[model samples]
Target: MLELDGTTMCKPGPLNPSIRAHSSTLTNKRSRRIKGCGALWGEIDHAQGVPAMLLISIQTLLRGALMVGGVSVVLAFSPLPVAAQERMPMRIAVEGAFPPFNYLDANNKLQGFDIDIANALCETGKFECQFIIEKWDDMIPDLIAEKYDAIISSMSMSLERRQKVAFTEKYYNSPSVFIARKDSPITDVSPAALNGKKLGVTSSTAQESYANHFYPDMKKTVFRSSPELYKGLSDGRVDIILEDKLAIYDWIANTKAGTCCAFKGPDLVDVTFFGEGAGIAVRLDDKERLARLNEALKTIKEDGTYDMINAKYFPFSIQ
Candidate 1:
């Protein structure tokens, strides 16, 4: 007759998914027998009487075995165990340099609409999140390399970018505008009106691509950063600036250099140049991660979280 922990081990009954077992105070005298029959037919050695920790592995292995009905199963499990997996935090990436969307405050802490949106998503999705800062140009490449998870930077969703990384639904769409000195007479956005004028745009962005494609005749001056472009504009180094309208709005309202510039003409939003809108980007192969972010984004928008963040940043809807 088969014996287990001094009890006759009969044919094992149907295994319960939630299996538990208890053991007496362990000693070096002999290996201990598990009370549960689900662990198949093995004696677990309780090292230094630490049944508390070994029992957990015993239960997990038993449970995992029960999943396959008495078959010895070899499986890799997370070091966190089942409960800890639920509390694991997600890693998110952001440029951390784009203000109004995402930037460091006076105290050098991350705070802005983009950060708020990321927090809201984490709340709605019931997951913890940690934001990481990456350079504007390396957002996509680093994402693919798995340096971080999702990107919440104010990255425009363009065809060229879509080819590299997957993007969630657009969070907001702001039109592009041309800004020049208030005294300047360039009122038209047409290439004919501003052909010979020097135009400044951020390097490697949709704005630069737009100017290069449409206004090829215009002297295109690419700056490495927004501040540099604005400096060029303020010092009369560039005759015009074309970029996101909301960014331009923030500049004009708060910065001294922006005071010298005003909107030149109507908003420009060609899909060919701008793609769709700004969106959160993720790794191309991470479909489930993408789905979770989309679900979180939808929940926030439906529950007014998005509106609250928007109002805190802009007076009008940028959506």
Candidate 2:
């Protein structure tokens, strides 16, 4: 008699002296037992009382049996080709609120540079990839919790963040800048120039860190998303906002609300706050996946695919 357990196989009666009892845990976390039948049939001698035909049948049965909630269920088994088996799609997380980089369209479909870049990398690498929209503040935490495999969001590679996750080579680089109403008197972003004015920035972003570090005395209003932060500037709730230059440029050139605001000062390039640039993020232990992404990034750039995507969003090269 044979029995299947979640991780071990057992025989009820005495063991056969001729055949040594053996067991093994399968990749799927299930195990099965036939008295004195080792994990591999080749190890068994035909001279033993057990027939070769019977042993082959038992092996087939063991492969098909699956344990579910303490009950054994037999399922039809068909092995797929190695290539077909390796085609499983990797899950990628993106914040669907950052425009020009990534955002939801009027149709609510994800569309932007990050989306295009992610698609290109996956295609060049022969990897199937799926994108999941996630909150900005929750991106890192959820990634660590295994909710997704990697983050292709425009996340800056700052030293503070490197303590938790690893980043691939930068896909794009843009400087931080300040935006304010065209009519506002604040021509300079110096903290002394705008003593009592309200400043807006998205929470848990590189821009926020920059503002907190450089303009610690300025009154700051933190928003949950980029759209909300932009709205705060337009609605007169905030006197100015600090954000990615390319993103602000896209708003000023494309959206109606952006017409009320304009770039306030020169580009801010403090590396302490902005880090290097935006890169894909994965768990610290996922070095193999990181290498695969870096190779794919190189392939796309060398093939002109990355240039094509960049031109779709910005007139100037951000790389």
Candidate 3:
């Protein structure tokens, strides 16, 4: 007989034939069973001549022991269920210079839409997530080097990036646009119209790719961060800047320093330049983690959590 929980006792013997037959029926319908302990315990209660309480106590004991490094002993009986295993904490990388999406506040703490969305995904997935500040250019290399498990910065899912990492379905989509001084003469925003004009773009971004691909003859000034890119336009270091339309709108409509600039021409979008939209990126090999993030993203969107976060950041939906 095996003693469990210092109270329940059951002999090691085959279950009664009738009980075994009944349990088999339950096992066959496992997929339709209601989730959680109650449904399982209720089914056990109906097994005739079997000590259901003893089995429950034993399961509880094994679970407690496994938590304290008894894996080998538990494996002797059966492998632990995937759901029973503790999940490793995830480290997420974010660029702390992009405002409204992600940025460092006055106290140097990370804040903004990206941070909030990352937190919501982690919460929904029951993951312990830690955010690491990384340079926009270094995010992918750092993730590949295992410095972080994922990059939650507003990274576009461009083809070049897809080759290096896997991206979850885009959390939000926004178009790219050009921004120039309100009084600037360059209105057409074409390569020919702006011949010899200096263009500002953040290095390693899709905007830079677009500028290089479309305006090879135009002079280009690359910046390392969004704030620097905007400053280049405001301080007259560059004649014009191209960036995400929503981000440009956030700066122009919300900040006093952005008073000098306004959108130029039409929204610029190309499947080759911006593959889809902003997505959370994980290492190419981390498929399990990527799937979890994608599921959590779907859950948050369905449960209205995503809408709350979106509304807090923007007046209209960016999805």
**Which candidate wins on lDDT?**
3
Q: TM-score of model 2 relative to the true fold?
A: 0.73
- Residue-level lDDT of model 3, residues 104-165, one tens digit each, is 56644566888778767765564555555556777898788887678888999998999999
**Ranking of candidates on lDDT, top first:** 3, 2, 1
lDDT of 2 at 160: 86
The most accurate candidate by TM-score is 3
- lDDT per residue (tens digit) for residues 1-319 in model 2: 2211111222112212332322211122111112111211223222223456965876878776778998989777554322223332456777767887887676445678887787666655544455566667778987788766689889889988898999999999989999999999889778788777899999999989888877888899998878888889999999999999887788899999889989988998877778798889999999877877887788878988788888888887888
Model 1 alpha-carbon drift over 4 Å, by segment? 1-88
Instruction: Residues 1-319, candidate 1: write the lDDT tens digits.
Output: 3332222222212222232312212122221111221111232222233346776876767675444676766776544322222322455666555667876565445667777787666555544455555556667887787766678878889999999999999999988988899888878879998889999998778999999988999998888667677878888999999988886688888878789989888888887778788999988998867777787788778988789889988999988
Candidate 2 clash pair list: none
Instruction: Output the TM-score of candidate 3.
Output: 0.74
lDDT of 1: 0.69
Error of 2 at 136 (Å): 0.7
Write the number of the candidate with greater TM-score, choosing between 2 and 3.
3
Q: What's the best-to-worst order under TM-score?
A: 3, 2, 1
The C-alpha TM-scores of every prediction are 0.72, 0.73, 0.74
Clashes per candidate (backbone, < 3 Å): 0, 0, 0
How far off is model 3, as Cα RMSD?
18.1
